[model samples]
Target chain A: MSELTVELAGVRFGYGAAPILDGVDLTLGAGEFSVLAGANGSGKSTLLKLLVGLLRPNAGTVRVLGGSPTDPDIRRHVGYAPQGLRMATSLPVSVTEVVAAGLAPSKGMLRRLDRKDWTRVTEAIEAVGLGDLSAECLFELSGGQQQRAILARALVGHPRLLLLDEPTTGIDQRLRPALVRELRHRADDGATVIAVSHDPDEFHEVCERILVLVDGRLQRITHEEFHHQFHEHGAPG
Target chain B: MSRLFIDFAIQAYLAGAAVGIAAPLIGCFLVQRRLSLIGDATGHLAFAGVAIGVAVGVAPIWGALLTALVGAVALEWLRAKGRLAGDVSLALIFYLGLALGLVVLSAHGGLTASSTGVLFGSIFTITWLDVWTIALLCALVVGAVALFYKELVAVALDEETARASGLPVDSLNVLLVVLTALLVAAGMRVVGLLLVAALLVIPVAAGARLAHSFRSAMLWAIAAGLTSTLAGLVVALLQGTIAPGGTIVLAAATVFAVAAVVGRRAARRHPRSSAA
Candidate 1:
């Protein structure tokens, strides 16, 4: 909890020519439960991607876990859940198969999961309340349940840092608190968590820190200030 | 059928069996990724490639492989750029391959009834070289899939998530297309260019209907592919006039129909989850 797990100095990035994150300097401490709130296309998701090493910075240095985010070894310790409902629902993949993929980078794709891996996968699934649906096909689950499946996938590897992009989008209203609690529990156990959300109210309930992405810069905002600003600007008049 | 008949068609039989396993195995990902038409698109390009080989006097399969690889590259380019939708790009290449094939076949003047077998597949003409080539190609596809199963599953399930997780998304995509080209090239022998897509797509479709898990679906797909190929070959041999490739496709279709019904019934019996 005392260690700096993420440090980005003068990081500049964009797609094609339109800049998204420009000269951004940021740092996150270990065991920090933080929410990144931003308008659509405000670089919130991009920041998470940059943290996970999915996008190489245009300029400046991005270090995750004291190594370049691009390093596979560094990324192996970073659990990331991307935004959007991208999982092909019609695809006949069981919940376990989805979670098992988190082990792929370490296990090398074709290797069968040993007992330990299976145990971790089961624990992760149960953590998200998907124990009963482990063998069920993805298309057989509701939208919220599917989101849990994706969460279980990210959690299966139990990385040192967790970066989730809108992890609550399709999640059930009832299960949302449990999901946050699980993440909170992980943070309490000394894992850094950085999550992106358009709606950060529920996230604020469990997270200790809240940062808003505005004008391509990370601005620290109090939990009360964030919800106030969100209502003022985000709500339709 | 006598043992002599079995012995004589052993090469074709072996090639067919390999297609039964390899085509559907690869097709599992292709179908899951919504790139199932890739087999047909590559097949069309293989058609043009084989025609060039036939007209130019090089090995037809080699020519098909070249064309298929070229098509795969084009597909990869289109996919990466996000410029053209997959099917549109495939359609563009499909027409080019089909038109080129027709022009080349007409200009070459070597297309007789037997030459028709080139497009329709003449398993009766399978050689030891053909069997070895198909076998070698199948082995590579299977081995690559086995070695990279997790990466492929990750990418296919969700490319962006897999990329974010540090999987080599671009290289894996290239690997997928290259493998598709190779399978299409090899599949041209047993099912011919016209019906090669059938073995690659239909089995996976049927498998999806029957299997609840990804592994089960792929296993079921292999079963469907193997049985259809075997039955089709046997029926085509017995019938004497039916095309082997077309007959195999029909057999796969029948299997898909049966699987759909059985799978639907099985699913109803469980009613396990409320997935939308």
Candidate 2:
């Protein structure tokens, strides 16, 4: 599609001899909010890593935003929040600093953040409801708060494509809706959002499509079918 | 018109001042990356370099710099390749340097008077030429850190995120180790090879205990470094018998002890600002 944000064609990948993803082909357009669901260790995170260029496929191509994901020019317009990723507590980096790091892709190296860039950092912090804790160390925050800060980092760039892995892992249930709504807003603003979640219902209101990984292949199913399959098979893998 | 000898202690102080400022500037990131021991490892490698230089009749500082640079680059390469665990590589480098230096020196002759100076540090033996050389290296280190502050912070904070964000993660990692090598070479004469890592790590610990952000931690670490170094040099000057290297490390340790206590109390008082 002319407005497609992601395209994967015959992609195959694995850690060693065993394969995780085999002959996978998919496409998603701009402004689409999608959920990737599978059992634990079913290659959902690996697939997201491929989209972000953190991991390369063993075969085939993964194109994001009209170019190879590994290209710096292309990556500048992509944002990713890895699963359960946390900075070392020994480091004294603050919330604002971590969120500001999100701008590095856009700014490149050797260029300092201007006043406007910092203001955007602050705006991202406030948007994630961490306005009061902007100056606090990231490790000092609760797990949920840290996840929110990470979300803010992913959101700060206003990227054309956003990939989040277990974005709601530590987020409070009461706050999950707000988090999903934020992702919804970003997708509505034309950013392609693909999130890996064990429970896709958490994103039921915002997600337009659900993709399940089973036998190293992607299967697209409707919400009703997904619910039936979930109850029938215990969980999709 | 010139005296037969100038105050070498004064020369040592001048050079120490540069080290005090630069070592901790590099230390902030090293400590953040949990590679504090890299300083110690590089220092030992520099010692081996210095020994080889002495054997070949080159300036020991240059030898130390060359060897340390090569060693830093090698360690980074190994770690980046993921063939060796980071700590294992560091340990191998550390012991290899120490043994290589000792064997080389023993083969030439037992530890000479100069070798002892390189080990324990001899402030009264510093030449004015050394002052200028150390100052130049420290300036270069400081300038590089300032220029790459944002990229360095992003990489040190979380490397995966930084790489995903399009930063040259591998290049930045190499830059950090190169800076560490340069610092070890610069400070070896003042802090001695055995204790140089103290300068790279202790002040950072003290600063991290009291500062809230990476920027402030660096400022505080630099402040602590200067205080320990200048004060230790003064104490050595007054005492006349103490080694400046040992005194400087002690001063830094004292600062860390006090900061730990004060930081604990402050954390109790303002639970949210403990990171500061």
Candidate 3:
């Protein structure tokens, strides 16, 4: 078996009285690109949050990188780009500064950024093709450009795993392909990637495996199965 | 000018300047986060502190500062729990503090006259002790912002992302609330509880419309704040009867209105510039 990057066994979680995820058993291996497909409120975001240690499961274990979800060391090796990008866009922050925030976890409170940090930030910005707009304020960028900048933030630290929650929500249709292509390129460079998406078409070409969340239940599927199920249901307008 | 008039003007300017500088310095973040009402809540809490201190014949400033800080921390904790909305939590805590203060004051037999000073500040009664306290608090607030500028900015812009990036998002958030409490406490003596929120929000809101960067927004907000306080103090002094707090708030509101108009016109002229 391939080395396990994430392993969740019978994990259950809920917000208040409502149960969102129940008995979710899943595993992701090293060097794998997996797409999580689910309808709204199917616990996709909750599951991602659980994996990243943002939330704790009520029952069972959630292990990422051979440690508990709350392990700081494991979290250091994983990067998460949340679905809520509105907060970053509304603030008067520059693209470069946003990307540089990804470097925050590794540095101490008083630690100053050195030349090496700048190099990493520049490389990450260039990777997302936002080098030209690095100095531009984030609120000034197009939605797709902003999404790319967020993606660059996730990739800057060269994390062992990347977890993106609904990354293409507000992205422009024309730029979708390029963004997916860039993500695929990063995965090709040997980083384990797990992305949650509502649209099967957007991730079909890039993902090697598919996991579907239906009413909080997780079901593993092949690419063909995902395409058949998703296409059969038709797209949401 | 007579020596007495000059002394009064200098004192008003000094006191107003201290609050003017501190309020918008903290307000920039508060306005951006849509937590402007929090300043109002903290200001009311400071009133409660002042009431309690007056009942005991202790220094009202100490009581006000401690209460405001505690209230600020409570507000943060409630928000973090995800149980209550920010504004609702603030309102609930604010009323509770006020009720407690009222009870404490009444229990000590009829309201203390000193409580009125907190309700509507007396700039003409400016004391050296109050000036020293405001100066010390201002230094602390400014120093904290300067030292943690980058980390604070990162968390304020996107807290979840900041946490993911490894920033101490929670601690930074708590620190921000503490600093805001300190600002409110310092301003309470100069602007009064009811008018203190104006100093915390109006200048920052106006500056936000004009400035293109976070740093610029803060700088502009500080400049607007200082200018309005100074101008308001002069106007109040000339009138000889108007309250300094009311004049300062009016001045800030006028600046905010002007900024809004200018910002809208500029945006229309430069359609491509994302001037947020």
- How well is each residue in B1-276 modelled by candidate 1, as lDDT tens digits? 653277536776789999889999999888888887777888888888887888989888899899999888788777788865746667887898889987897789856675577678888788899899988888889999988887898888988778767777889988888888888888887888878888888999999998889999999999999999988888888887778888888999999999999999997897776743
TM-score of chain A of 1: 0.92
Interface RMSD (Å) of model 1? 2.4
Q: Find the 10 residues in a row with the least total lDDT in model 1 chain A.
A: A228-237
Interface RMSD of each: 2.4, 3.3, 3.8
Which stretches of model 3 miss by more than 4 angstroms? Answer: A1-3, A14-20, A88-93, A114-119, A132-141, A199-206, A214-217, A228-237, B1-5, B82-89, B99-114, B163-166, B273-276
Best by TM-score: 2
State which docking tier applies to candidate 2. medium
lDDT of 3 by residue, B1-276 (tens): 253268667877887898898888888777767777778888888877877887778787888888889988887787788755846666786787778778887887637555666777777687877788888898888888887876877777777766655566778878988998898878877888778888988888778777667777788789889988987887888787788888888899888888889878987887643321
Error of 3 at B32 (Å): 2.5
By TM-score: ranked, best first: 2, 1, 3
Residue-level lDDT tens digits of model 2 in B121-143: 76667788888989999999999
Which DockQ values do the candidates obtain, in the order shown? 0.59, 0.53, 0.32
In candidate 2, list every pair of residues with a backbone clash: A214-A237, B210-B276, B211-B276, B212-B276
**TM-score attained by model 1:** 0.90
TM-score of 3: 0.87
Error of 3 at A116 (Å): 4.4
Give the CA lDDT, 0 to 100, for residue B271 in model 1.
Answer: 76
Best by DockQ: 1
Q: TM-score: which is higher, 1 or 2? A: 2
